[model samples]
Target: MTWNYAYSQDLWPAMISVASTIFLGFYSWNRRNVPGAKAFAIGCLFAMLWAIGTSLEIAAMDFSTKIYWMKFHALWQIPTVTALSCFFIEYAGLGRFLTRRNLVLLSIPALLVFSLMVTNNYHQLIWTSFELEEYVVAKYGIGTWVSIGYANLLGLVNLFALLRLAIRSSRSRWPVAIMLFGQISGRFMYVIDSLYNHIFSPGESVLVVIGLSCSLYAFALFHFRVLDPILLARTIVIEQMSDGMLVLDMQGHIVDINPAATEIFNRPASSLCGRAIVEMMPSDSGIEVQPGKIELTKFEINLGLGDAARYYSLGLTHLLDKSGEALGYLLLLHNTTEQRRSHELLLDKQRVVATLQERERLARELHDSIGQVLGYISMQAQTAQNWAVAGNTGKTVPILSRLSEVAQEAHADVRESIFSLRAGMESEWSFLHALRKYLDHYHTSFDIDTELLLPEELSEDILNPDVGIQVMRVIQEALTNARKHGGAHKVKVVFVEEDGYVIISISDDGIGFNQADLILEVGKHFGLTFMRERMTQIGGSVIIESQPGSGTTVVLDVPIGT
Candidate 1:
């Protein structure tokens, strides 16, 4: 009910527009983890504030009914321009690959233009405000579109940059492109119309809203993949590979074995518990068990391998401990199926080479040991046997005072034979055979059946060195505790799938104690405490359930990120 030109009807839209923009700004600020989310959101903050500031002039005019054009709403154009400019840069990816020099050069345009617009707004540059007949009209200056032709020009540059980034990233750009199309095209049209007259003054905010929602939709679609990118990629490659791949831990237990590996070994991963590498390969080149970043020779098995006649060039690398011991080996096998013909000829050549090596080892052994021992037999026959066991029998010259060599020839022959056997076996059998043998010994010694469950798909996720060792540790601790504390008849361990987690359970019908009571008393054994700590260190939680005379159940649930 105010007088003419006093209360502008457009004030309501101004408030609502700015308030919505500010809300978006605050929402994006809180979600800082999202990439590029801050850019548009931050720009919206300034845009909203400036929008409110611009509308305040309407209130001032309502109070004073001022005819002064430069009094109130006019000053707001500066901040609005500044906010939108920055927003455009981020949404368009204009700053992504921008050099420092390029940015510095770009800043110069704003300095020269912003001041010019503020001082002479009604005449030149992006827009010019002219007076129409009465009603205090502001007409468009020449080439003035959306009150800022220069602003739109800069915006186009930003949009093009964003388009390029979306295209070049080799990523899904459908969602982003949809968002940009809605935002940039809508804004472009508005800017073009504004140059002619007051055609599309403020309706472009609707398209801006659409753009934000599309971006959020895109983020939701892509978030889970970011957590475990390699797992998804592994699934794609598992079936495609031709060569066999087997992964194992330090204890020679199966971590993950591919379809080809299972076919070659005639066993699934679960059945090959603690199996030694020697049992499968049983070749001279398979004994190197050191972990971390090693290139080992391919294991050759000659039960007359038909199609697998070619040598496999194996690359073995180890993860290490801080004390510099091998933690585990990463095994990669390159199939050299095309080289078996060449290899047969090479093997013939290798036999000749080995004959030379054998002569040298014997000569060195005699020169370094047996011949010396025979000479020293008169001096120290009793002492030579003791010296050989000490691994330094050849370190000293024949002793002069107490020549006590005991059965020196026999002792030297035994030592030489043992060394040769170890060297031969080290190259012959792999860890798989050893692991299976160890598990067999455990079953025989403890009279407990150990069960292993494996997944159908052998994956890099399951084969990771840290993860495999942790699983083994969990199993080891659970078994040790069951044997020590749980006075039960039968021990059962079941691995099941639950809520994207690999669930493990160890339980026995032992004399159970109240877990809650024992924890409260602090007087019980530290075994449970140690187990709990180990589980906690690996980002997994352990639950213990027990009662007086009932069996105890220990559950460890681990996430595999598959």
Candidate 2:
């Protein structure tokens, strides 16, 4: 004989379960790449299977058919707790502990239980007897209690894991808390139904509770952005990056800091968060600004903590909303202590090498100029002595006068070399001060009138030492060229800031050579080439304005970034 099944109102709980299953399954599918999503999907599949089997059992009218459906439903029920445990572990960021070996071990009990229920006819271990009362099927056996006990144990484990995670992370606590409460309530209802007959059929109240809980979960997932916190925390690329990151609110307070940031600040994230950023900044950092309208700022800062000091290049950008309103600031700190130190050390080595090379060049110039003049004077003295010994006084007078003139020329050359060497060795003056001293000396020595036009608001500290050196060298070269080559009698210098650059202009009231002559005979005019190279090295430019019978004007434009 064949049996036909009829629909039952009791299947409402199963319908709800199926709907929840579809929603959760789709949720898991959408978040397939997300951590723990596979485990969540597995749990949803098992839950859906449980709902289908339970629906079949409730719809059956005969005792044997109900028993058959009940046994089939046990297949879904037996693994539900295990799958939930796996999901909970992964969801809590404790997936490292759930190895393949551990999973296989966990599956053993579920498999054994499933097998016992399927072969209940041969062994009677799952259900020794079955009875139908008011269209409800109830089973009694040692296996029934054992399955409940095992499932409860697994549920307890999942609850504990989620509870631990909820306690640890403030961002994801609510969702985990809700899941824990739901599992406890559903298990309590299951135990109550098993102990005494209730208005709701066996497993119906539990399914209803679970289904409601899943709905709540889906709501939390879509509505609250519940997954983002854990996702960011576990993403290996961001977590492992070396650059420090900080997310700040518009209140100038520290909101969130990454691990690298924590290390950079030399404080734990717990203590650093919620504190005002001004308190953490170095005294010289100059980061003072209103909270909401953070300016686009980029600079290097040095933070000193006892014996440990580090340099960091700080960059601040406005975190804007979709409508372009200011949300907060994203601060990126790139640690540059090692790189800066290496660069400084390299500069130091270069300076030493340059000093040695300069000394060699000076030695060669001395030998070629003053030394040659001195040797010529010695030869003239010997010739004058021979002329005097021969009593040729008439020839001696002109020869002695020539010797005196050569001696005077050598003396001037020696004085000039000493002045040049002294100027090269003086390394500790501000750019403006050094240029002033140089111009004063030039005016006093050459009797040239000098005028200086300087911006009073210019801060000396803003100029980089390296840039100052290059600028000063260019000024010196231009002044020397004006006095010697162009015979400049009056000079003017002006300093101004324009378009993110510092411009210094030096003009002379001297006869100037043709610009074409300077370009064509570049080898003879090494000073202009040196000035151009020095300006270029510091991301600056040089402009020369000159023509024959017109005074030359040299303008140096240097970017302020350096």
Candidate 3:
């Protein structure tokens, strides 16, 4: 392997190509973080290698030195083509194809071509023969044709990718077009040099084409910012949004729909477009789309029947042109199916808790009232039996009489408990309405006159369901005690608002008791204890005003917003 050097006119263009490619390689390497930039840098490196080898081959005087350099330059062409193909593939947003397995597959042909070029001296598979005139010329062999075909295959793929990108992107069209022109011109020059070697020598052609291509690449990279990320347009935003979007013409016909809308409707865009907006809605959706009738509207809609139904919050607004003229309507549908299901589940859990609470309250009432009464009756019967057996008939008769009275009171308590358990507010019934109904029933059942007084500005919406139920139970207990224990003939219930509080006063025309006796009486009478506990649960308080001779009054102090 003897080496020799001589001056040649081709050296200038080859050196220029080397410098230009080296600059492009480093420039692209600086932006390697950008998509496709690393691959482009690698391609520039291979192009630089080809330029260096071509320059050395042009300066070599001996045929043997020239042939060796030619082989080196030819070997680099395979890798350069492969690297550029990878760049275009990534730039076209198809980088998924560049998996490790696919990269290995892509490199197989380059490795095979390299092996054939290296062993060409033994088999002459790359260049059958070489002739040295002013430039080294070679006759192509089967291996050379194979390498050419493989390179052209990759070149076509790169061209298709760039062309697709140019067509699809309006903002990057100019940059893509410039790169496409560079690729086409480089390939065209190679083809011309291959066909007409007398007019265009291989070394000069390769250097000139590499320099031209690198200049075009630099222009696209610096002047047009080709490697920078593309800004999202309104259409791109609409297309990629999670919420479904529909654009309808002024006549309420669908003009365009995004992929999300297509998925929501479970139909293709072609079918959805040119159709009336109402035609796609479920029959019971309750959505009315009247064009120009309203400036903006919103409502919830159910799209399917039974368990498969999906809920969406649909918003409609007029799409206006720059001149303020109504162009069409923009319908935005946000899926709320999960939220609706969550709300229903929450209500179910609440109902379970309410039912459990009601059962516990009933259990407490039975234990405090009926359980104590039954125990007292059992003890009184045993005492009466002992008195009768000892021949003390006078004491036994009074004990038996007292037992009968206790039995009657227990029966009345049972009835009252049943009534309280059965009393409930209907969905449409207000707290005041339920209270009035209970009072009417009490008057008819007990023959006790009842009167209700309410403030004029009282609102039914003031009390929530839980507060209303607790208040009603407390009032019922007070009215029952006024009749049974106090022996009241008439009751007056008054509702008055004072200082952000609703004070309920129940006055009874009944025998009064000493205020000092309430502590001892509360232990014996669970009704009074239960009333205080109920009010306390709802952030309220109960006060009893009474004397030995005057009528009694029960006052409840309840906060307005509780």
Candidate 4:
């Protein structure tokens, strides 16, 4: 082919189209990793090629050179339309249709048209005849009409995708509207150029007008951030998060929910949206979801029953607009079932440890007190039997009386030990109430009168449960000593709070022993030792006061908040 080039008025518009398209092509290419950007870049590049070929065809003076450039321009037209169609489909969030197989199928028509246009010399199928007039004119053939129809069909699909997107997404409407206008304007210019060439042709290539219309795409891209990945990233994060998320309106109705939220409620998003949140919650959830009344930041709720039970920590957050006006609420349900199970297991282990410790203490008490007393009684009985067999009644009588007294003391100790073993705090009873109940039971069992004097201001909340148990044990020991050792008829237990300490006094109207003699025998008295040890374990102290003629008093000074 021979080339003869001459500049025409149409060269200016074609050159402008080339520059604009090349700029958009490079811009789109830089954002190729974003959804739909690669296809948009391909479309821009082909549009640039069409502009370059049309410029060359318009400037050529001979029919043959003009025909060659027209064929080149025609070759890029189908690829441009196909690429833009794919971009629109992807932009509308219909990327599932753009599979590799579908892309290959879409390209087949472009390839067939390209081959026919390239082989037009042998078939004369693309253009039947060419004339060199004021402008180079060509008669269209069956192949040319077929390519036009296919391009038009692709354009219609692209328009439909954009229109649907504009209708569904309010935020995306502006950009989609711009793109739709560009596409429709390009198609309209093409139709006007083809049908009214003699009367309305402005001596400019139709490619120039189409390329200018596509510049609206570049404007939308720059102004609206059409290729930004922020929206896509947000959607992915929300859908894939492990924590269930719900977006609710000011009326406490579900506006939207993530996939995790759907799974948590065992309902679809379509079924959940527009329904009241309280209706969706479990009946026993105890969640107050009355819009402005939902002040709870974190709450635990149980769903299901038995082995299928799940625990969740629901967190509420207020959604506000820029003006600080409340828009809605966001509910985040985090699964805490595993954490709850672990806590229960720990409590079980603690209970086991406490039970073991209690058993060890009981064994020690038996060994230190009852066991030793029983052994002494056994030795005395043997001695008395020996004396009686030898006919020595004088020594045997005194020994038998001592044995009777020791046996009675041992019996009282056995009863006290059994009472201590059976004592436990019930969940519903307060410490003071339980203590009074125990005193009533003690009076009935021991046949001794007991009086409890408690301070009116003293509350059960001040003492720890573990410390309360030890205090009760110490009180029991004091009452037992009053009856068995002091021979007391009546006892009074008094409680007083002073200087951040609770002072409990257990006084008995018994024949008291000398304080000096009691000090000397302190190591032999297991009850006193046990009481002191128990009080010390709970950050408290035990004090005993007595005189030869006065009553005995056991004083407990327990520090508050221990």
TM-score, cand. 1: 0.37
All candidates' lDDT scores? 0.52, 0.76, 0.83, 0.81
Task: Estimate, for each residue in 331-365, the C-alpha lDDT of model 4 and write its tens digit.
Answer: 99999899999999997997797688677877877
For model 3, the superposed segments whose C-alpha errors exceed 4 Å read: 1-37, 47-77, 87-101, 115-141, 151-303, 310-350, 370-562
TM per candidate = 0.37, 0.78, 0.59, 0.65
Clashes (N, CA, C under 3 Å) per candidate: 47, 0, 0, 0
Please write out the lDDT profile of model 1 over residues 1-562, one tens digit for every residue: 2334445655666566666666666765665344444545655655555455445534443333422322233333334444444544544445464456765665565555545556554556533444433223355444334335556676566567557645433232554465456556645554554444434333223223323433443353245232123533463355346666666677554555555566556676456535766456655655554442333454543333675454555655565779998766555555565576677789689668655754665575465456666666645645655666677745434542244343543473444334433322343443223223433543564666655444455333442333444454455556556654665555666667667677778777778877677758773444556566556656777888888788788888777652
lDDT-based ranking: 3, 4, 2, 1
Clashing pairs in 3: none
Q: Between the candidate structures 2 and 3, which one is better when assessed by TM-score?
A: 2
Residue 141 of model 4 has an lDDT of 85
Give lDDT: candidate 4, residue 28: 77
lDDT of predicted model 2: 0.76
lDDT of 2 by residue, 1-562 (tens): 1255788887888778877887787778677667777777788888788777778877776777777776676687767778878878887778999999999999999999888877888988777766677655465578878888988988878877887765544456677766777777777777777667545673465365567667766776666554454555554455577988877788878877777988888887778889877788776776766745654343888778644878899898888899999888988889998998899899999789767755675576567567778888889889989999999999999989998888876665465446544554555756666667777876786688899997888877546776777677778778877876788889999989978898999999899878888767766655687688778878999999998889999998988868
